[model samples]
Target: MRGVVLHAPGDVRVDHREDPTIIEPTDALLHVSATCVCGSDLWPYRGIETVDGPSPMGHEYVGVVEAVGDEVTTISPGQFVVGSFFASDNCCANCRAGYQSACRHRVPMGSLGTQAEWVRVPLADGTLVPTPRVPPDDLVPSLLAASDVLGTGWFGALAAHAGPGRTVVVVGDGAVGLLAVLAARQLGAERIVAMSRHEPRQRLATEFGATDIVTERGDEGVARIRELTDGLGAHSVVEAVGTQESMMQAIRSTRPGGHVGYVGVAHGVTLPGEELFYSHVHLHGGPAPVRRFLPQLIDLILDRVIDPGRVFDLTLPLDEAAEGYRAMDERRAIKALLVP
Candidate 1:
């Protein structure tokens, strides 16, 4: 099989690799139908996250089950499924509490490399969510999105406490951020503010139910949000970018008693204890427990109630994944879909 391997910064290649097989009774082998490049994948590609060697890349995936271990009963071979970036034994205490991302037996799927013809999924019965029916070709992208970005965005909205009569602000205009805007609307946020300077993203934000767009950055951006909210700041703020500036902007743009849901992979970020003490804003975020929301998100996509797949502005064959990475790094694409 062929898979993406990150040899170094700006060096992604499709190389031959050994195929995957079920090594554990709880594991399942999948014939990956669709996979994509994630914003987080750029961390290693850009050297923000150090690479010690050629590492396997990609996590988001939707595929058909080709085989399952003896212990995996619920998910049978031939079923189409979507799974989270983090695989979990959904029966764990944390999973029971709706935090599958922190399950006792959690495993990062990226390490298994889903960007290939086939991949192995651990905790198969508890981690993979089967679709109602075999999804059509057109729905593959949307189902694939649910595997990660859509679920993450939904988690962001939930963490931020977005609901009716509340004003919500979303920082970062990437795919996850845009989907966060969509999630906020679906969660009943009365007003959605998306901070973005790019026209394409701003347009998608509006289409996704953004009531306003703020193109400013740093303090100015916070001021704009404050001005729009009558100096009280937003009722909830979603921080989709993990940068120090974006995090500060999210904290500053929320009211004293509001909540901030940060989903961006934090890199070189440090929050001053004193500042946080005075801000009085609630902050909570980490890798999204996507498995917790996979069922609902999958239903939404299957019902055609939401079209989050619009986040993928570029598509490429699995062999051309390097170009997909370049497109995203160069800001020429919001997200890239890789068809295997």
Candidate 2:
């Protein structure tokens, strides 16, 4: 098998790697049909996140099950499936409480790498969700999106309490952020504001249901949200960039009783305890428990209710995974889909 390996920052390569096999009775092996380079992958690629020697890359994946261990029941060989970054035992306490990302037996799939021809998924019954049948070619990307970004965006909207009559603001214009707009719309938010300077992203945001676009950042970004909301700020704000500036802007852009759902992987972010205590804003977010919403998100995609796959502006063959990373890092692509 071949997969992506990050030898160091700025040095990602597609190299021959050992094929994955079932090591646990609950595990399953999958023939990866589609995979992607996520915004989070940029962290280590840019050196902001440390790269300690060689490391496997990629997490979002949609595939066909080739084999399953004895313990795997719900998912079977030859079924098309979607799985997120975390392999969790969905029967755990946290999973039962709708936080499968924090399941007691969760495993981060990135360490195993999905940017390969084959992938080994653990806790198969709980981690993999099968589609009703093998979807057509056009629906593959959308199903792939459901593996991560779409699910994360759905979690973001739900956490922010987006609903009928609510005014929602989304910070960041990446795939997740743009899809947050889509998610907010699906959740019935009355108004959706997308903060983005990039024209392509702005256009996609609008197409995804954004009622307005704010291009400013930092304090100016917060001011724009206020101006649009009649100085009261939005009823809910979704932060998709993991930066101190983006985080603060999100908090300041929400009204006193509004909610902020931050899904960005925070990098060196810190908050002033006193300011937070006085803000009267509610904050809730972390690694999105994508598995929790995979089933519903899959149905939405299959029903043609949402076209989240439109976020993938670039597609490349599996061997060109490095170029996919480069395009995403250079902002030349909204999201890159790699075909294995």
Candidate 3:
């Protein structure tokens, strides 16, 4: 089988690798149909995060179950499924409390990168949610989005308490941030303010439900948000980019009593205690417990309540994943979907 491997920084290649098999009773093997590059993947690709020899790439995936271990029962071979970026036992205390991302038994899916002809899924019953049916070809990208970006965006909105009568300020214009705008609208937000500098991304933000676009950065961006909100700041804010500056912007753009739902993967950054103390804003974020919302998100997709797949403006064969990385890194594409 062939899988995407990162030999070193800026060097990604399609290489022959041993196929995966069901190694645990709760495991299942998937014939990957679709996958996509994530913003976090760029951390290693850009040399911000170090990588050792040939590390497998990719995490988000939607595919058909080819096989399942003896213990896996809810899902059977031939069923189409969508899973979160991480594997978790849904029965754990944290999972039962709607925090499956922190399940006692959790596995980072990146360790088993889904960008391949086949991939192994652990905790199949808990992680893989079978779709109602095999969707049409075009729906694959939308379903795949549910595994990560869309799910993360939804989590961001939820964390920030975005809903009817609230104003949502979204920081970052990447796929996840754009999806955050979509999520905020679906959650009943009255107005959405998106901060972006790129014309293409700005257009997409409006199409996704943003009521206003602010093409400023740092303090200037926060000022624009405050001005729109009558100096009180937005009622809620979503931090989809995990950099120090973006996080600060999200925090500063939110009202004192409001919340900030952050979904960006943090990298070598720390928060200032005094600043947070003075802000009086609620902060909550980590990996999204997407499994908790999978059932509802799937229903929305099946009913066409939202179209999350628009984030993938570019598509490529699995063998050409390197181009996907380059396009995203160069800001030429919002996201690149891979068809295996």
Candidate 4:
């Protein structure tokens, strides 16, 4: 089989690799139909996250079940499914509490790689969510987004306590951030402010339900958020970029008692103790428990309540994944969907 491999920083290739098989009774093998590049993947491609030699890339995926281990139940061959980066046992204590991302028996699916013609998925019964039936080709991209970005953004909205009569601020314009704007609207927030500088992203954010677009950065961005909220700051803020500036901007943009749901993959971020301690803002977020929301998100996509797939402005064959990575790294594409 052919799969994407990152040999080093800025070097990605689709190379021949051994095919996957069920190594555990809880595992299932998927004939991948669609997969895509993630913002997190750029961390390694840009050398910010070390690439230990050639590493298999891609995690966001949707596919058809080709086979399942003996222990697997509720999932069978011929079913179409979507799964996230982390596979978890839905019965675990954390999973039961709705934090499947932190499930005691969690498995990082990236270790198995989904950017290929086939991939192995563990915790099949708990990790993968089947669609109502085999969906049409046109629905694949949206279903694939639910596997990661859509769920992540929804988690961001929930974490920030976005709901009726509240003003929400989203502090990133990437796919996840853009979708966070979408999530805020669906959650019933009275106002949605999307922080973005790019005109194309600004337009998409507006389309996603952002009532205001703040193109400023740093303190200026926070000021704009404050101005829009009548100097009290926003009622809630979603920090979708995991940098020092973005995080602080989120914190500073929220009212004293508001919340900040941070979903960006944190890299070298540190908080000033005194500042954070006095901010009086509620902070919540981590790798999203995507499995917890997969069922609902899948339903929404199928029902056409949301269209998160619009974030994928570029699509490529699995063999051209290197260009997909390059396009995202250079900001030429919001997100790139890879067809296997």
Candidate 5:
């Protein structure tokens, strides 16, 4: 099998690798049908996140089950499935409380490398969600999106408490951020503000239900959000970028009593205790519990009520995985889909 390996910053490659096989009775093997580069993948590619060695890359995936361990009964071979980056038992206390990402037996899937012909999924019954049937070729992308970005975006909206009669602001314009805008709209936010300077992203934001676009950065960006909210700031703010500046912008753009839901992978961020103490804004975010929302999101996509797949502006064969990384790092593509 061939898979993506990050040798160093700006040095991603597609190379031959040993094929995956079931190692645990609770595991399942999947023949990956579609996978994609994630915004978070750039962290290692750009050296923002250090890599000690040539490590396997990619997490978001949608595939057909090729085999399953004896313990895996809920899912079977030949079923199409979508799952989160973190594999969970789904029966843990945290999972029961709707936080599968933090399940007691959680296993990070990036190390398993889904951007390949096949990969092993641990705790298969709890981690993988089978689609009603094999989705059509056209619906594959949307189902792939639900594997990560769409579910993460939905978690962002839920964390921010987006709902009818509330003004919501999204602080990033990446795929997840754009999907967050969509999630906010579906959650019934009366107004959705998307902060982005790129014309392409701004256009997509509007198409995804953004009522306003703010191009400013830092303090100016917060001011624009407040101005549009009649000087009270937005009722809820979704921080999709995990940088210090984006986090501050999200915090500052929400009203004192409002909520700030941050989903960006924080790199070198530090929130001053005093500032947060007086800000009075509620903060909630981490690895999104994507499994918690997979069932509902899958239903929405299958019903054609939403089109989150539109976020993928570029597509490439799995062998051209390096180009996929470059396109995203250069901002030439919002998201890149990889077919194996």
Candidate 6:
């Protein structure tokens, strides 16, 4: 098998690797069909996180089952499946409470490297959701989105309580943020304001259901959001960037009692306790429990209610994984999908 590995900061390579096998009675080996680079991958690719040696990269994936361990009865060989980025034992307390990402026996998808010809999925019954069948080629990207960005965007919308008659403002213009706008609209948000300056992202935001686009930064961003909302800030705000600036923009753009749902992989961030205390904004974020929403999202994708896969503006062969990373890092592409 061949997979993508991050040898060190700025060094990503595709090399031959041993194929994964069923390691646990509950595990399953998947023949990876599609995978994509995530914004989070940029953290290490740009040297923000220390990369000691070659580490498996990527979490988003959609594939077919090649083999299943003894205890896996729900899925079987030849079945196509979509999995959450985080593997979980669906029977756990947190999972039962709809927090699968924090399941007592949760595992990250990166540990097995989905950016490969094949990989093993832990907790098969809990982690993998079998689709109705192998989908058409165009639907592959939407299935892949279920593993990360779309799910995260849905989580952000849910956290912010986006719904009927609410005005929602989205912070950041990355795949997740753009999808957040789409999710809000799908949830019946009356007004969706997207704060972005990038032309490509702005266009995508509108296509995805943004009612208005605000090209401003910092205080100016907040002011535009407020002005659009009749002097009050948005009823809900989704923060899809992990940086302090983006966080502040989310908080400032939301009403005092509004919720700020942040889903960006947080980096170099600390909030002043006093500020939050007086702001009265509800802040909720962490690794999104995408497993909890997989079933519904898959249904939506299959039904064509949403086309979240439109985020992948660039596609490359598996061998060209390094170039995909470079394009994203250079902001030449919003996201890159890799096919094996």
Alpha carbon lDDT of each predicted model: 0.95, 0.94, 0.93, 0.93, 0.94, 0.92
Colliding residue pairs in candidate 6: none
Among residues 3 or more apart in sequence or in different chains, the pairs in candidate 4 whose N, CA or C atoms overlap within 3 Å are none
What lDDT is reached at residue 218 by model 1? 94
Q: Candidate 2, after superposition: displacement of residue 95 in Å?
A: 0.2
- Residue by residue across 67-88, what tens digits does model 2's lDDT show? 9999888999999999989999
Compared with the true structure, model 2 gives a TM-score of: 0.99
Instruction: Judge candidate 6 against the unseen true structure and give its global Cα lDDT, from 0 to 1.
Output: 0.92
Rank by lDDT, highest first: 1, 5, 2, 4, 3, 6
Identify the superior model by lDDT, candidate 2 or candidate 6. 2
Count of residue pairs whose backbone atoms collide, per candidate = 0, 0, 0, 0, 0, 0
- Ranked by TM-score, the better of candidates 5 and 6 is 5
RMSD of each: 0.6, 0.6, 0.8, 0.7, 0.6, 0.9
* Model 2 lDDT at residue 227: 90
lDDT for 208 (candidate 2) = 99
Q: Is candidate 3 or candidate 5 better by lDDT?
A: 5
* Cα lDDT over the full model 3: 0.93
Q: Write the per-residue lDDT of candidate 4 for residues 101-169, one digit (tens) a residue.
A: 999999898887889999999999999999989998888999999999999999999999999999999
Candidate achieving the largest lDDT: 1
Better of 2 and 3 by lDDT: 2
Q: Model 1 segments beyond 4 Å from truth?
A: none
Error of 1 at 212 (Å): 0.5
